[model samples]
Target: MKLKLNAISKSFGPVKANSNINLTVDNGEILGLLGENGAGKTTLMNILTGLYKPDSGTILIDNQLKEFQNPREANKSGVGMVHQHFMLVPVFSVTENIILGTEPTTRFNKIDLKTATDKVVKISSEYKLDVDPNALIEKLPVGIQQRVEIIKILLRNAEILIFDEPTAVLTPQEVTEFFEIIKSLKKTGKAIIFITHKLHEVLEICDRINVLRRGKIVGEAFPTKTNNKKLAELMVGRTVKLRTSRRKMEKGKELLKVNNLSILSDKKEPILTNIDLVLHQNEILGIAGVQGNGQTEFIEALTGLRKASTGKIVYFGKECINITPRKIHALGIRHIPEDRQKQGLIGDFSLIENIILNTYYEKDFSNNLKLNWLNAKKEARRIINQYDVRTNSEDISANKLSGGNQQKLLIGREMSRSINLLIASQPTRGVDVGSIEYIHSQIIKARNKGIGVILNSTELEEIIALSDRIIVFYEGKIIAEFPSNSDPKIIGLAMAGVK
Candidate 1:
């Protein structure tokens, strides 16, 4: 299969997401698309998958020009996409989800369950995908769920595959396994477009790479022809120091301490148990774990968003449980919540309003019950500039911006407060490469200024990069701890509870 995108251009309102981008993928090749956050990688891929029609472009499949009006049309034309987020039904079995919409049928239009299951099993074994046909998707791990998504594409007989940030949520071992599977697909003569921000993976797996910056293809290189430093420079269009610059710190006393933290669900089942942790001023403590492994419970308990049945949360030598969220906020604890849209920002509120959301009572932005719009706008603009938030109007509603921009706004809003302790969970998730660097630097800067930082993220690179010390959370317990220079493999094993 050969895919060619010629002069592809797409725009959303004033933003030119893809500006005359031209690229090609030959048969049995993995062409990597590298870009900073807000680059046109996702936009271009969306056009290829028929999610968005390019304002102007031509797509050629096997030297024949084609037009895709919808995803079904793209699928029928032998194109398929596996998104960063899987699209499997939770309650349905793998076979059921795969055969949906185009079930195997007889003359009477009756479903053929046995044939579907048999095909799924055969395809799984052939590609080494190893998914169980009868297993429910909700019961599978993140990696297995990803495989099911891939299997869905295979079942459609997709010759061209587009993988968007595929390894963002996998363990180190699972990533290795996935790479092998991708290689197998390549050997089977499938054209693959691999989209990711990780420079090292581009070097490891991709055959050739194209760099996109601000809606244009800036550079192209083969893996063997370039190094990470050069690729990073190309992606950002500047020399980027990959490591954080932090000043040596004289450690202060513990500002936040959690001992024997335990949480029981509404049904009286234990969600978290026997968790002990501490955060000291001038130290960045990273908690590394897979998602849904009690990280949410631990952070929610400390931030006063959720109640824990049994736990001792001491903040600045005072117990924090049973305290209201307002009281917790008043105590100088800033939380950059995990789910930004749900917990961090009010979607209907203007940027100015969201900026002063928790601190509106201050005399600078408000007096008594009245909000000074001028002062609020001034604050919002300051945050926008300081945080490099890309927005044309401060009066625009919070929901209008992209995901990365939304994250930037939340981080800026939270970090502006006079904070003694900061709880940042998945702080840079889904953010672009440049914003990711900025966020990491800010976290380190806060630590340098003697603020106790509790960083929790699923990204192992982030965990290893920004942490002064790291702890692994598994099954609601602190399963392992390591110092700054710990090996990645060691920490990875601990993430899976392998002591």
Candidate 2:
């Protein structure tokens, strides 16, 4: 099988997402699509997957021109995409999620669960996916859930597979396993398009790499002939610093202290159990853990977004447990939430509005009755310029910006204020290498300025790089703690609940 996108161009209003983009992937090969955020990689993939119609282009499969009006048509033509975010229903079983849209029916016109389970089991075995057909998605690990996604497209008989940031959430061990899976898929004569912002990943696994910049294909390179620095420059059209430089700073006064923090769900089940930690000024305390291991609940409890059953959260010697979010904000504690679109920014609101989202009631931006639009817009423009949020105008809706830009905007909003403590959860998640560098620098800057930072991220490399001290969370408890220079292998084991 072969997939070809020729002269593909797409635009939304004034923003040209893709411009005269040309690309191809052949069977038994993995083509890496590399780009910074908002560089039109997603637009090009959306066009290929029939999510968006190209203003001008021809999609050719096996030398025959084909136009896909919908995703179903694209899937029928052996084209399918596994989105960055999983589309599985949390409550659904693995087989149910795989056969959700295309269910087999009995002669009586009823869903055939037995047939679907058998097919899912067969695919899982054949691809070495090792997924349980009866397992619920919520109960399964992220790596296994990814396999379920792959199995979903395989059941459609897809010859062309597009994986968008597939390894973004995977552990280092899982990433190695995922690469083996990709190699196996290639061996089976599947055309794979691997889209990611990780430079080292493309160099490790891709047969050929194509770099996108400003909605155009700037360059292409083979893995052997290229390196991270070259590829990052190609993606961002600049010399990108792949690592952050941190200066040694002594830990200062205590900014936050948590003692016996325990949170319970509405059903009275413990979400966070007996958590105790402290954050000192001029320090970045990195919280390392696998996803769903009480990190989210702990951050929420600290930010006043979630109520704890029992705890004493002392901020600057004041007990602030169960305080309102606004009161927390008053204490100069800023938070960059995990989910950017859902928690960080209001999609429908303008960038200017999102800039002052939490601070709109402040004396500078408001007079307690009406918003001071002039000052708010000025601050919005300042953040846009300072944070490098790529948008044409501050009047545009927050949704108009890409994922990375949205993140920068959120970071800018949180950091622009007078904050002593910054609770940045997944600060650079889904951001490109260029933006990651900037965000890391900003975080280090905050730490250097005597601001306490609680950095919670699933990415271990990030934790190792920026953190002065590290703590591991496992099953709702701090299982272990380590210094900045601790070996990552030991930390990884600690994250897996090994002390």
Candidate 3:
């Protein structure tokens, strides 16, 4: 027992983020902290890392009571946290960013770049995290930035590491490399607390697993003794069928057609190049790829958020290129944008306002003559009930909801529209176990009802499981297409542009 948390509790107003949470991690062991979004996982980790002060609890480090006032104090106590988003300064060199606060100084208080670079390199080599200390943070890929963060902690000689959703942005190969680094860290006598919603990775890397639900620890198990299905049941409090089941489609006529499409990014490079694809009614076509491979740009072009340089987009047998976003919505197309915070919903608006956002001008929820707040509230309540969006009140602001609930609200709102076609991108990203299952079912239901569906996700399992036909995107080009029943490793290889 290297670290033990006893009866930790925290709350925000009436909402308890964590309640009597008890957890333990042994030295040199990797423990998985499994939970859905807003299940108190992040809050507990923040308390451990000194970002939050627990309302009631005692933290025992080596059986001694300890409290951290801030992150630096936690660092001094041999605990470090790497957040889901990289925190490096883009323009700074790796060494500079690593030693930003804890600078190597002389008598004059000037930064000693040589000493900092030497320490960074030594830590990187010891952890097998090969990074150029002098390279600019922005010039490095996301994986290398992650390595720099880890090296920062190791350079301070941290004995315990906390990683929050570390592989969410990584490619499959990069995920493998990250696992190797984690294994190496464990061998170096460091206790690691791994936090993620990815069950496969938990089974692959963790020795013991802790499941948190509704701000409390619910269950514990050894990975070798339990499977994903069982762990999912414990986390969700129900026996959830993890796989997505879709019937063989009776393909209808084409609903959307893209011919010779090319899109230039703001940097004036071809982010989508000569792409041609079609989605037929009653079928789901999934585009699978690693991040930065042009999937975002492709989705933007189809959703009327970006313009195609030279191409023809025919939605419902009518030309649609260069149309405004409002025009696209009026044409009976519902798009769930990839970045929920930026594009999916208005963070400052109430749930009712967000639910009727694109269609509020219509006569159903509102009219050209007058607005109907009552009907809009009624419709919002319907979506909230149907989508299982857990909230105390629909009057709450959209940004106040958890990530999973926000995603659910977005999906429910879009699916409420009687659209001819639907475009969903990274729809299940950061959602919890139960919400993921429900969202997948809803998408399949929409396809079964004769609406053409275009699915984009970096998760290979999601693409493989939900798509009838899967296309691999590489550098803004469709490299290959495969049936959904193909082996997952095959698609994994395709996503890496190996095929």
Candidate 4:
């Protein structure tokens, strides 16, 4: 199948999400869609998959101009998209999920479960997806769940598959497996569109790369013709500093101490067990692990979001185990939560409102319970300009910003306030390369200024680059500890619970 998007444009009020876009994906070729967050990548894909109608464009599938009213219509036309967030029902079996929208029915109008399972099995085997037909999505690992998504697309007989940040949640090992699957799909002559923030992955997997900046196609490159630095520059329109300058500094007072910390899940299973760590001013303590191996719980405990069942959290010589999150923040502790959508920013609040979330009650932002909207906007403008938030107005809702820019807003709001300690989780999870570089530099600058930091990230390279010391977590326990200069292979082994 050959998919062509010609002169696509979309707008919401004054925000032009996509503008005059032209793209093509040929059969048996992987077209890499490179863009920063909110760079209209999602909007363009939505248009192609029939989620949103393009304001001024024509979609040509195999040179036939067609208008699709909905995703099912696009599916019938052989277009399918695997979203960044999985759309599977947690309780449903893999077979159920794959056959959800377009089920095979008998004359009696009943779902033919056996036929669905058989088709799923055939596709799984053909693509080496390694998915069990009867496996529940809730019980499957993230990587396996992604395979289920692929199987779903394949079952729909989609000739053109769109993957949006498909590997964002997968571990390094699972990434290799996914690459193999992409290779198999290419061999099957499928036209694939891979959307991701990871530059190296694009260079590794793509046949051709197109860069988008501010909703316009700015540049195109082949893997052999372009490098990470060039792609990053194209994406952000600037020379990016790819490395963080984390310099050695004099160790100051002990900032925090977690002794024998333990947490139990709702199932009464230990999620974090006997974790011990120390953070000192002027240092970054990076906690590295595969997702769900107690890193979330540990961060929650430290931030006062969750209580530790059996342990002590000592901060500046005072016990802070059961303190309220607000109290912790009052004590100069700031947190950049892992889930930005749910915890970091309120979707309905304006950019100015969200920027002053922590300090709205202060004299500058408010006076005797009345908000000073003018002052709030000024502060918002300052942060946006300083942090390079890609929004034109402070009145715009934080929800309107791109994922990367939302992160930047949060970092700006959090770091600008007076802080004694910073606990950042997945600091650059969905951000682009340029934003990642800037955020890393900010963290390093914080550490250099004698503020203690606790960094939790699934990316090992990030941990190695920013951490002065590193600890690996597995099965709710600290399996290994190493200096930042330690071999990554040993760290990888520790992350997999192979002590």
Q: Where does candidate 4 stray beyond 4 Å?
A: 91-96, 103-118, 133-136, 358-368
Q: Which pairs clash in model 4?
A: none
Clashing pairs in 1: 37-432
Predict model 1's lDDT versus the native. Answer: 0.87
Candidate models: Cα lDDT each: 0.87, 0.92, 0.88, 0.90
Evaluate model 4: give its lDDT: 0.90
**TM-score for all models, in order of appearance:** 0.88, 0.93, 0.90, 0.92
lDDT of 3 at 106: 78
| lDDT tens digits by residue: candidate 2, 78-144 | 9989987678998999999999988999999999999999999999899899999999998898899
- Pick the TM-score winner: 2
Off-target runs (Cα >4 Å) in candidate 1 are 88-119, 134-136, 264-271, 289-293, 322-327, 339-380, 391-403, 487-499
* 1 versus 4: better TM-score goes to: 4
Evaluate residue 483 in candidate 1 and report its C-alpha lDDT on the 0 to 100 scale.
90
Off by over 4 Å in 3: 85-97, 100-118, 133-141, 265-268, 346-377, 395-400
- CA RMSD (A), model 3: 2.9
Give per-residue CA lDDT, model 4, range 1-499, as digits (tens).
9989999999877889899999999999999999887798878998899999999989999999979899999999999899876788999999999999789998899999999999999999998888999989998988999999999988888999999888877878899999999999999899999999999999999999999988999988999999999999999889988776666777789999999999998889889889898899999999998887889889999998997899899999999997899889988999999878778999799999899897888788888778998999899999999888888788988877876788899989988878999999988887888888888898999898999999999899999999999998898999999987678889988888898
Off by over 4 Å in 2: 134-140, 265-271
Q: Is candidate 1 or candidate 2 better by lDDT?
A: 2
lDDT of 1 by residue, 1-499 (tens): 8999999999878888899999999989999999876687877888998889999999999999989998888999999999855678899999999998889987788899899999999999999999999999988987888998898999999999999988766756678899999999999999999987778898999999999988999999999999989998999888887776666677788898888889988899888998988889899898998777799888898888999888799988888876888898888889999778769999899999999989998888778888898989998999998887877779889876655678899999889868888899888866766777788888888888889888988878788888888999888788999998689889888888898
Error of 3 at 375 (Å): 4.6
Residue-level error in angstroms, candidate 1, position 240: 0.2
